[model samples]
Target: MKAERRTQWLRGVLDLCILGVLYDGEYYGYAISQRLEQAGLGHIKGGTLYPLLARLEEMSLVTSRWTVRQQGPGRKYYVLTEQGRRVFEEQASDWTMFAEHVATLIYRRGE
Candidate 1:
C-alpha cells in the first residue's frame, strides 16, 4: 500500500522525534538529516531543520560546536543539553500516549 501523507501536526511531532535522535549522540546537519530520512521522515526539509536547530539552541535545548576534520571542512555538531534530555523524556512519554490514542482512533475508523 502507498504511504499516507503527513499533516502539519505530524511534522510538529517530528521535531520532537528529531530532538530525541540528537539526544542519543552529537550529529552534524547532514547526519541528522540522513538519520531522520532513515527513520522514514524523507519529507522533512532543510528549511525546517535549520530553523528547528536554531530554535533548540535558543531555547537551551541543544548546543552546537564547530569542528574541523582533516578529511573535510568544518561542521557544526549538535548535542542535547541537560535540559534537552529532560525535555526529551517528557516529550517521549507524551508522544507515546498520544500516538497510542491516535492509533486506536484510526483503527476504529478503519473498522
Candidate 2:
C-alpha cells in the first residue's frame, strides 16, 4: 500500500525527473534509469519509462536517436530539446512551489 501510494506520487513528477536527467546530455534508457535511481528515484521500469519517453518525443519535448556500438546492441539515446529545456525550467519552478506548499502543510509544528 505504501509502495502503491509512492508510485502514484512518482508518476506525477517522473517526467520532470527524466527531463532533469537529460538536462545534462544525451543518455540511453538504462542509463537514464540509473541516473534516476542514483538521484533516489528508485528503479523506473521500462514499461513506465519507455512510453513516457515516446510521449515526450511526440510532444517534441525530447528527441531520440539510435546508436550502435561495435561491442553492444543498439541504444536509443534521448536528449532534451530546446523546448524541453524551457518546459523543464518552468515546470521545475512550479513543482518547487507546489512541494513547498505541501511540505508546509504536512510539517506544521502546531495545529
TM-score of each predicted structure versus truth: 0.87, 0.95
Model 2 C-alpha lDDT per residue in residues 1-111, reported as the tens digit of each score: 488887998989999999999999999999999999998878899999999999999999999999988997999999999999999999999999999999999999787
lDDT tens readout by residue for model 1, 1-111: 234546456566866977888988999988998988788767567788888899899999999999989997999999999999999999999989998999998889746
**Model 2 misplaced regions, further than 4 Å:** none
Worst 10 residues of 1 by lDDT: 1-10
Off by over 4 Å in 1: 1-4, 7-9, 109-111
Estimate the overall C-alpha local distance difference test score of candidate 2. Answer: 0.95
**Alpha-carbon deviation at 76 in model 1, angstroms:** 0.3
Residue-level error in angstroms, candidate 1, position 8: 1.9
In model 2, which range of ten residues has the least summed lDDT?
A: 1-10
RMSD of each: 2.4, 1.2
| Top candidate (TM-score) | 2
